[model samples]
Target chain A: MIKISDLRKGIPISNDPYGDLAKIFSMRKDELIKILNDMVNKGQIIKFRALLDHEKLGYRVSALIAMNMDDENIEKVINLAHITHFYVREKNEKFPYSYFAMAHFFNEDELKSFSKKLDEMHINYEILRTVKNLKNDVK
Target chain B: MDEVDRKILIYIQNEFPIDDRPYLKIAKDLGLDEFEVMNRIINLYNLGYIKKIIPKLSKSYIEKYERALVAIKANEKDIVKVSEFINSFENITHNYLRDHHYNIWFTISGKNFEEILKQIKIITEKLEIDDYIILRSVKSLKLDTEFEVKK
Candidate 1:
């Protein structure tokens, strides 16, 4: 079985995958191709993707919005284009919100608009602007 | 970004070809020169727009491991120290400081719930944190990280 650490090391964050992956894995082109294909076929690999920086792509603001709402209202939140990730989590007395979403906006105005829409829908939510990205390395 | 650049970004963000000559394939599909596609991608990477091109693992594949989003309410004075301590764990993939009562939020994954709880215990004990919550994901409504590039 392939170790997760080895897999992560073999595919470090870079734009140039053609040169980096093979060299890091120390495998021939054909051998590496077969391994990658096998992993994909086994459902271990989803798809190759380019992780873009939304901030550099004109998204100047990002926020984590936690919501306390029913399941019926989730589709409304999902319909919003700015929401990148949405999840339903176990809630408790201290953390009363069960739903969480991460959204990116072009500016604070966009966030305000989003908040207004949530208000119109009567969705109880708290928008927490991301202060700093401490770490985001692939696990 | 121009129209062509936007198109390239959209295509790659959705499905980057996993082939020996992925860029060449992208160029062919977009009816552009291979060199131009390669140059554009490299430029985007250099400008910090494209963080990386990586093989995303399947959700089901990773669901074997228990994962939870832990939120910690650390004092402003010790925020930096607390974050550094959390980042030291390889199991912790994402750590972010947000403007809220539970300021520090991070996602951690482990082989089981007990293992994850053990790690959290160590962190809480070391940092002497009393106010925190572990929000285990029950259902993921939408988890796509890709942002649609607009022209």
Candidate 2:
């Protein structure tokens, strides 16, 4: 069972102190390190990442762009290591959408410049934006 | 680390007492001394379990806007350049290279459709990304579960 102690330890220590389990449990520094390492090895801890408010940072525009892989086999396409955290979904050319994807930018000109590159590469894509955010992790 | 602390977090997650002596009310609910409850809260913060104790702002109550999650397929040879290009924009919030084919993922918020399209154009050009995908969130669900695994 996932214990409250686990919750205490799962508090990501990267940013918030209150999220640190060692401090909450008063564990020794070494013990804290061991616990974190063990959790990571067990796949209970996936990643330590930061979530920022881009709109607050001046990113006024953003969109989702789905693409269709021209190649039948995704070997060469998959080999393109630049793409990260992408998944394969059912392909749909008629819908003008493929697997899910995302992008963010500061201005229209900046976004347009990127589109030109897509055209040159012959990559098909579309853009979607949130009409409203029902819930987001504020803390 | 104990049940009391767990209760404190659960309570705070749902609602934080708005009274002058919020800690006292919290203590009453947990059957603990006011000072002890305050100490536990402080310790939780120090330990890194509780990121923040802030007001829950209802997104619906605020000015409504659209959001999108963009994924990019950049050549690994140009990953750094692509990341730099994406990060250069202040509007591109929460960009990361996760382990996948579409490695570069980011969340973007815009005022309107035009603004969203504009960004898409700029990022693809700047990064020289050949292929990409967009996952539009038709329905969103969020769960607040602290992950902890003990043997």
- Candidate 1 on B27-123: residue-level lDDT in tens? 9999998888988887776777777766676777566777789999999999889999999988897899998889999999888889999999999
Per-model TM-score, in order, reads 0.91, 0.46
Q: Please report how far candidate 2 places residue B122 from its true position, in Å.
A: 2.8
Best by DockQ: 1
Cα lDDT for residue B129, model 2? 64
Docking class of 1: medium
Question: lDDT (0-100) at residue A75 of candidate 2?
Answer: 43
Label model 2 with its docking quality class: incorrect
Per-residue lDDT for B127 in model 2?
Answer: 60
lDDT of 2: 0.53
The per-model DockQ list reads 0.61, 0.03
lDDT of 2 by residue, A2-121 (tens): 332244223432332333445666765456556644554565543232222334435565554456656553344333322222444434332445454445566677678866766766
The native-contact fractions of the candidates, in order shown, are 0.77, 0.01
- The global C-alpha lDDT for each of the candidates, from Candidate 1 onward, is 0.82, 0.53
Local distance difference test, candidate 1: 0.82
> In candidate 2, how many Å is residue A123 off?
28
True contacts kept of 2: 0.01
